[model samples]
Target: MEKPLMIALDFPDLDQVRQFLAQFEQTDQLTVKIGMELFYHYGPAVVTTIKQADCDIFLDLKLFDIPHTVEKAMEQLGALGVDYVTVHTLGGFQMLQAAKKGLSDGAKRAGLPKPHLLGVTELTSISEQVLKEQQNCRLDMNNQVVSLAKLAKDSGCDGVITSALELSDLVKSVGTDFEYVVPGIRMHQDAAGDQNRVATPKDARKDGASAIVVGRPITQSNDPEHTYQRYLKSWTLK
Candidate 1:
């Protein structure tokens, strides 16, 4: 998408999505994320609804399974013609390859442009403590994210969904050829909520993030359109 910010529509059902988007316009050229909750409940029909609004879609299911199974599922998702899709980078090289293949094959068959495949690295909600104790990894937070990012590139994925705090290392290690999408964004006044590695949109931009994902700050705002425009200005202004 031309815009660098994508809103995460974390709403539960189609009605809420329709209502939220009604505040904006087709000219907004908005890019939105349809996460597991929305997709799992509404299925592909939600994609059709989002499309009707003339916005770009990032289908963030973060698919992780056996290669063949993920591949088949991606075939269906690709046919929806969304702008981006995600798989877990921990799923390893062969699975990433299968995801790319499945998406391409499905898009080609349906005569649609293939969506970019982004691998989800360690989630921003995860802290170093969680990385060490819960996941039992020897490398520190940055190392693990970079490792997974390298694997994504080697596996032929287009980009990675990672945290803003880790962006500098990724840009250096993974380089400019890959897209670095940062989430868990929050303003200085906003509560951290469940996220541990949150950053402001300006921090993401200065760190060289290709895009940023914003949720509640915009979605739950009292005046969502005004809030969105504020964020858009913040994101674009130098």
Candidate 2:
């Protein structure tokens, strides 16, 4: 599969998604992400719509639940034929295994390729202080990310979704073959917004990230296509 630059479609409704994607009508083979906002609003049917448009979907539901619940949910999500999906590594070994099993079973039933199961290590919005104070995590940020990434790999996940800041350490700990789908990507001039740990596309590439998820920098730009092309160039040129 091609290394993807996933554009997070963080719109509130289907029409806004349509409007956003319309800008890329001439550009085929896009890898787009459908996060909770649009997924909850439109359900699985949005996947079909995006498929029809010839775009690959990375369904970013960030599933975190009991093993049974996550398994059943993965079953349903896998059947949608999305290219990727995410689950929280914090869910533990049994849950990750169950999720993987469900994805396989669902894909087998539907005769579709199983989506890449990405385990989320931590949200970019979270800080080391926040993690220690609120979640009672004892390790520093890099150690915590590496630890969760190791658990994800051991429990059958295909890769991990982590901040670009953690990519180098994660690769060192988990090995280079492990997929690192990084979020919190922003250009130097862009605002950080809610994300605390951010990196430029060039930085993510240097850190050996497999892919990067970019949100407002592209979607909210005055020239979305130009910004998208810039990001693509940043990854492709070096």
Candidate 3:
């Protein structure tokens, strides 16, 4: 299967990553996602070690901050040579522009291919009510995602990280230019965990997700390799 499976390595310890990869031994078939937990522990060494193993990686730090700060951080992160990285769409236009500039300059300096910069629209864990009451946003769930997705594209992002539930609409809004990297994909029978919105792997593919970010479903399963392969087969099917 040629579908990209970004295994969300949300594990806190680097050893857990090593154990998981050792057990699976299918690095070529799957890309790794280094989120807050793993990156905080092993830092760039985690990205470096995974690259040395010949596995594509997504640095899922979801960078957010002032324009210069986020830009500076991206400059340093680009040195790791991962396949992709993320920034929050809520960071606004100038911030996103700064990030793009940083990535371009850093990649040129390091003589490596530029990483795909994705924007995180809204985490699937948060609901529309919270976004309205707490975050003080009046936009409904779908509109909220659409608004941020447009902002991401206008700000020069290659893609946006959204839940599968809104991916189809986001695709319609943004057309074919921007990529929709959907997360919060769970099997029909699996527990939804912290995710408030989700779709099954097959549903996500059917909804036009360019890539699916799966975490606990495969990582926490007893037979992760089989589970992973099942998803790969499912995504490959026409």
lDDT digits (tens) for residues 157-222 of candidate 1:
999999998899999999988999888988888777789999988888889888899999899998
Ten-residue stretch with the least lDDT total in model 1: 22-31
TM-score for all predictions? 0.98, 0.98, 0.96
Worst 10 residues of 3 by lDDT: 1-10
lDDT of each: 0.91, 0.91, 0.86
In model 2, the Cα lDDT at residue 85 comes to 95
190-214: candidate 3 lDDT, tens digit per residue: 8999999988778888888888888
Task: Give the Cα-based TM-score of candidate 3 against the true structure.
Answer: 0.96
| Range of the 10 consecutive residues with the lowest summed lDDT in candidate 2 | 20-29
Q: Which pairs of residues collide in model 3?
A: none
For all candidates, the clash counts are 0, 0, 0
